[model samples]
Target: MDPLHAWKDDFRREVEEVLAARARLRTDEKSAPEEGFGGRIADLVIPPAGVYADLREAVAKLKVAQDEAAELRGRFDAKDRALEREREARERLKDSVSRLVLALREERAGRVEAQAEAKKARAEAEAAAAALAEARFDADHAAAKAEDWEREAMARLRGAREAQAQLDRLMLESDAARAEINSLTARLEATACRAAEDGQRAEEAARKRDAAQAAERAASARLAALEDESRAQLARCESLERANQRLAADRAVEAERLVSEALVRAEHEARERAKSAYEDGIEAARQRVEAAERALRESRAAEAEAAQKARQAISALADFRDRTHAAMDRLGERTRAEREQAEADIAAARRGEAQAAARLAAEQARRDAALEEERASLRAQFEDARAQVEEESDAERRVMRERWQEQVQALEALRRGFERGKP
Candidate 1:
């Protein structure tokens, strides 16, 4: 609990003290300038319902959300200050009220003691006949004054004790007791005035009563009536005293109820304030948590770029592999074509060598046949020329033989002649 709010008073203050506290009401914080115009006016013109009701009204009128929030913050701060001032006022008012309640109690005690003293005085005066008249007169004067003061005191008590307490019924009963005492005192005074006025008559009647039995009987009857009236008044006074005691008890119970209610209201308000603060803290924590989640999302925002680069690298690698495979296939095909062309060239060279060898063998056969035919013709011509030469030589020899025979005859003759010529 706040220190100021913890204070409580046992009873109300005296009348003058209550008047002073009432004077301070105009300067209470509920009417402070910081509050809205409508709120301040209401506090001045009427009682408040709740502390923040006017602030809530102000928030409802704002069109912008930000302005509404700002106004609410300002109002909350003002309410805290108002609460502090309320605590101080409550403490001061309780002190003033406590004193007032105590004064009322003191007044009641004085009245009860006064009544008892008057009763004792009456008994004493009746016992001493010498001062009876003087004592009765003095007692009646004191009773008259007490009754008048009682009336005034009860009226003041009503005004001093506001609805802050529940002892109203007790006050009303007190007023009734005061009125009953006033009526009883008026009857006693009137009886005394009548008795003094009839004193001469009473003496004359006494002389007549001695002279007659009927007169003495009437005097006894009048005395009896006066005693009965006195007894009735005494009974009424005792009943008033009992009622006063019962009202005192009821006042005690009412005071206890008032204190307990104040404590309960204070506790409830404190709990509500704490709950509002906790809710504001939870909202701040939630905003921080959302910011953290957003930061985490932003950190990994480039995943698509990295994935695209990886795909490009994979495509390039596949294209390089395809190009390498195509080059190898082309190299293998060119090598096979070169080998086939070399084999075809070798076969053509062998066929060309065989045709050249066949031509050379035919030309050698023709040259050998021509040489055999030329050799046979030259041998036949040489044999024919040799026979002709031999025949011609034999015919020459025949002519020579004839000539030689003749010439032998002639040679003998010529030999003789040559011998003769050589010799």
Candidate 2:
């Protein structure tokens, strides 16, 4: 045989053994022989009919229990499927959350880079302004040097003009030379004034350049500081990203663990349900067995009662037969006695016989009536016992159902709690 088939066969054999054990248990529950005055008498006589009826009822109850056990087995299968679905859902949710965390970290990094570039651009603009101011100052300084040379030339031209004027006063000087001197002096003074103004403007431009350079340096220093801050921020962001990744990993692990735990819990719940059903089946079977035993006991008691009644009837019949024989014997012996004695004895014997017959008849009637009463009593007792048993069974079933419902509710609440805790 194939291994699978062998395993199946083994399972079937185990089930069959269980069923056979149950059957044997039921068979052993057959009523203990009724023990009472009536019961003993019943053993010696014909049995009553009520016994069969009780047995039939017990058999019916056993069938009901078998059906209930089958139903519980079906419910176990459904619970197994539900638990598996819950585990799958939890795993999917955990994966989704981890991916979202990674996306968020990437977005934050992009923002930090953009902010750092803006700060660098602001620093460069300040440096360019400083360089332009320095170039303007240099141009002004060159113009000032050119102006000083023109001033010295104008001073020499002025001295030459004064000598010419002195010569004109002592001995008539030339008109052309005087005119040339005047023109040279005027051009020289104009150059010197223009140079002096350029020098002053150059000095002012130099001061402005220096101030601008200082401002540029200060701005650059601030920009460098900002760059350093950005670097630090970037580092912090990297750290935060790492931390976020770690947190995400931790969350994933935690989620997986939670899913695993939920799966375990679901499995545990399924097991608990199976166990509870098994226990319920066992308890129901036990109650059914107990009821069957009680019924059997009642049946045996009734049978014993019927047997006792039959024995009583047989005893009465036997006594009647003996009395009749004794009367006949007396009749035969009467001839040997005196007439008066025989007559009186015969009359007394006849009366005695009649009394015996009447008593026998009455006893027969009483026996029938007692048997009826006993049967009625037995039926009433049986009914009462059956009713009490049913009521007790019902009460027990109700209590068990309530307990089972409470357990189911608690399990459902636990399932809900697991769902709530899930990511």
Candidate 3:
């Protein structure tokens, strides 16, 4: 083929491509439905031209097309710059979204941590409540025990008083027996003297003397029996006193042992609980740190991927630059309008995101406040319960001590009374 013909054919193909590009741009504009300048640009139609008669004419037309293509290329470059700015804006929006997502994830993590802490606090509160209940129960049990001891002591006192009364009655009986013996001895002496004076009635006097002697013997036997009974009663009293002393000693020792055991057990449990809590906290902190490191790595990877995608888009746009010249001419005004709309849309989206973020923040703050308030209330309740338990325990102890003292005093009084009556 002739060289000129080949040139003409190439020129024709370029023109056709330009026309196709224009058609495609018009179609794109129609699809988007712009108005005013952008609309007019899209609506403008280029008529198809007939084939040129000669090479020179075709060359001149080709030169004109080249000039128009250069202008289009310049406009395409401007549009490309605008597209780059829009891409930057999109990248910023994506970064904002990523930050928002990261923030939401952090908020979720914080919420989980707070919930865990709340759960731990609740468990601690429950443990404290159980301990308080146990303490109250122990106090009640001790009080009941003390009351039982007091009742036993009182019963013993009543028995001692009755024994004392019995001893006094026995002593009175002994005194009467002794008086009778003395009177009998005086009567016998009188009868014996009268018999010595009256020899004629010696037989009657001897008989009377024998009867008197029998009566005196009977009186002496009765006095000996009374003396034995008194000695036995005194021995019984001494045994009872020893028993009372032993019971009081046993009770004191038992109370001291119980208190010491309770204190040691409580101290041990508290130390164990503290150690467990500290270990759990350290483990939780370590887990959180690991999770944070993992999240940071993930975020960095995501950022790098986003940057890679942006670079790929830039390379694609650069590749499209040559083909987009014809379409760029028609797209100039449309791009500006689209940019404004995109910016407005982005602003609206940003505003919406900001509002959502604010609402989430407010909700988070409110939840934190509520959790704090609940924690404070629980702490106060626990403290109050602990104090009440302590006070009740102290009061019970004091009461027990006072009762013990009273018992001791009563026992001493009994001992003194027994001593006074001893002989």
Candidate 4:
């Protein structure tokens, strides 16, 4: 059998045994008078019928107790089932809490990753803007160098024109006659030719300066375009940086939300756990209270049973005592009557014996008187005879008198002895 069942059976048996013992005590109390009086007289003399009635009552009480115990056991079994269900519920709740915690942790990690990525993107945008600004500075420096070269070339061309004008005046002022003049003219012509070539070179240089200015202007335009592209790129970078900042802010807010949610969930779970524990404690306390109540009921039942048995025993004893007292009263009355009759009979017999003794005494006295008179007459006669014989013999007369005196003394002793024997 299961251990719980075995324990229950053992407890039930113990209760039965206790009840049986109480019953036996009650039976003994009920039957006590039967031992003093023999069976026949006991039936008429003792009260409460027999031990069977008391035993029946005790058996009935035992049955009631057994039924109550069975009911309590059933209630306890139901409580056990409720406790088991609560335990299962607690386990399920704990598992759910564990999963929520794990999910919260994963969300926190994701939020951190998003934040790191946002920082990295902002750093890249700053670096790109710096490179664009350095490129714009290099373009501006190259345009300034081109402007300086154009100014220097124009100054050199102006100086070369002034020298050529002076050489033309000298050639016009020279004489037109002779070898010297011709030689001077040849020199002037050469000078003029050289000055014209210098002028042409200066014009070519001015053309080149114009081309350099155009190139510088083109470079400035390219630089401006580059600056505009850089500005656009910087703007795009700034937009991306703003986006990263916004994303970081959003992720921070999301992380904070997750943390707050996790905290709220944990608080809710804690409250649930505390509530469950409180309920469990209350259930346990209720079971304890129920058990205590059962125990109190059993104790009260036992006390009531004991009191009932005691009352019954006291009643039986009182009845038995009353019967004994009645019997004793009847016996005392009979003894008194018998003693009175015996006293009366003894008084009558004593009167009769007294009367008979008085008559016998009177007869004995008359007989004694007659015997004394006869004895006196015989003596007197013998004395007279003696007187007559005295004339013949004195010795014979003396002997006869002495014999008569002894005969009288013996008769008196016999009479006294007979009076003593009669009573």
Candidate 5:
């Protein structure tokens, strides 16, 4: 193959690469859809709460980041303008600078967005903390109310039990008194019947005594026996009255004791019930407190994680910015060296032509042609390298963005799920 053909082929290949690079640069300049931290933070919070959670750390970070970003952006812009002017002479290099500027702007915008997102996350955390605190306060208040209600109920129950016991004792005593009255009535009826029979016998004995003296003596003996029996019945009635009084006293004492026992039992049962209700209320409140505490802890953890992610993003942005500056510095050095070499070549060519226009003109023309070809080759290489760098940087940025999105979405989802589970 001819060397001219080979050189033409190489030049043609470089032109194709440059065209491809132009297309890629255009694509990279197109902005991707912006997913802000606000949306993610909104997803973290529930609908009922407007805002909660601690935000001091995230807010501080955002403030610092915003200030830093402004500084970096100003520096980047100044540097970019200088580079743009310096690269204006080279068509391929101009495109690279333009692409680098666009990339820098995108990186700054991404960093700003990440910092804003962290601030939003902090707001959500604050909202959650406020919600948890409110829950705890409400729970404590409810528990206190329940305890008060339990105490009041217990007091009422005590009074009711006392009243019920008094009533029970009175009923028992009344029943005992009624029983004693019935026994006394029956005994009186029996005594009256006996007295009637004895009177009838006395009447018969007197009739027989009227017939004879012996009958009269027998009637007297019968009268004496009847009198003795009357006395005995009277003594028995007195003894029965004494016995009834003693039984009444005993029944009263027993009834009082029974009432006391019943009252004690009732009081114990009531106390137990009140205590149980109070305990249940306390337990429920405790569970709510525990749940709220757990949620608060989780929200704190998520916020901290988001802050950490934001910090990492900022750190990565810083690193990228440093690399871009280093690349710009190296590009500046290259441009300077290229300018000096071109000046030297121009000087050497001029010297060659001036020294021998007739004898050295062909050699000088050949040297000029070789220098032009070498410059073309170098330009092609530089364009290719710059394009490759732009493509690699864009790819890395896209991958990092996707990873951050996935992680944020996952964390927000988990936080929502946990909140829903809380009572």
Candidate 6:
């Protein structure tokens, strides 16, 4: 198939033909001596000396061409070795590039995961913020309720104090009334004893009636004036009794109202009225006692009747005191009950406020802990993502630089191979 091989084949055939012809000549010379015609024919067929010289020159050129070809072949082998090394280097570069690409993909995946985590952190933070806001709102609401409860408790406490003061006043008035009743009872007993002691003296004075007629007229006039005063006092007592009844009815209504509403204004007004009524009743009783004393001193002829009237007055006063004591006792019981109820309500409200405050504090603490933990987690994630990105970037830059250097070296090798290939 090759031109060089064909040429070699042709040269080999020529050398074989020459050698065979020479061998035949030797055989003929040995077989027949002094063959002049055969020798002359052989001499005629053989080439000239110049022709041999030309053949030798051609042979030397062929040897030089073979040496050149051998040199070319050696260079080609060196080129092939260089090419093989380049191919191996390219394969290594390609493998490195594949690995780099895979690393890049993995980095991208990591970035995506980091982004997702960051997003999740943001969502959780937002949720925490919302929960914290809600907790704050609840705390504020609880604070407002506690304030309202405190205000209500204060108002109720004031009311209870007022009621206690009223009760004290009533107790003092009751004590004063009892003292007055005792004095009235002693006066009544003294009056009855005086009336009995004067009974015989009054009969003895009957004979001297004419002699004491002028004195009796004066005493009767004085007695008339005293009677008018006693009548007026009795009317005043009846009016006072009617007023007391009205006040009692009003106090009853006010007490019921106070039990239901617990309004400060209403309770205050009721207390003021009851205090005024008590004061009025006490003043009336003192005036009646003074009027009875005046009547007893000025009316000598009517001393026994006066003592009887005094006894009735004492009886009425005792009855009034009993009624007042009963009313006061009932009012005190109701007031105590109301105060107890208010205290209980206040205590319950305070307990509720305390519970709410505790819950709010716990929620605030929990929210703070969650927020702090979330912040720390986010900070750590941010640092890790930043570090990973920096490492990947550095790796990519190094790979690119190495690849560029490899490409440049391959190009230089190719240029040198081309230069060596030239004739």
Top lDDT: which candidate number? 3
Distance (Å) between predicted and true CA of 46, model 4?
39
Candidate 2 is scored at a TM of: 0.28
The parts of candidate 4 lying over 4 Å away from their true place are 1-199, 322-423
Put the candidates in lDDT order, highest first: 3, 6, 5, 4, 2, 1
Quantify all predictions' global Cα lDDT against the true fold.
0.43, 0.46, 0.62, 0.49, 0.49, 0.51
Instruction: Tell me the tens digit of each residue's lDDT in model 3 across 25-99.
Output: 888778774553555565566544544346668778667767876565465466556656766666676666656
Estimate the TM-score of every prediction.
0.22, 0.28, 0.56, 0.30, 0.27, 0.35
Local error of candidate 6 at residue 231 (angstroms): 46
Tens digit per residue, CA lDDT, model 1, 30-145 = 56556646544455565466646876765564334435333433443454455446444544544444444444344344344434434443333233322323333443444454
Query: Model 4's lDDT to the true fold?
Result: 0.49
Comparing candidate 3 with candidate 6, which one achieves the higher lDDT? Answer: 3
The number of clashing residue pairs in each candidate reads 11, 3, 0, 0, 11, 0
Q: Across residues 189-291, which tens digit of lDDT does each residue of candidate 6 receive?
A: 5555676777765454443444345444555555555555544544443454345334434543443343334324433554565566556655765675566
CA RMSD per model (angstroms): 95.0, 42.6, 14.4, 71.0, 42.6, 60.9
Clashes of 6: 0
Off by over 4 Å in 5: 1-212, 318-423
Query: Clashing residue pairs in candidate 3, if any?
Result: none
Backbone clashes (count) for model 4: 0
lDDT of 5 by residue, 1-423 (tens): 121233335557977999999989666545323433334556555554323333665666657665654555455455445444443434333334444444444444444444444444344334443443443354345445534544443354344444445544554554554555455445545555676768765554444334444434554565556555544543443354345334433543443354345435544654565566556655765675566557656865776577567656644544433223454455446546765776676577556644544444465456557655655665565456446544643564455346435534543453343324321
- Candidate 6 residue 179 Cα shift, in angstroms, is 2.7
Worst 10 residues of 2 by lDDT: 117-126
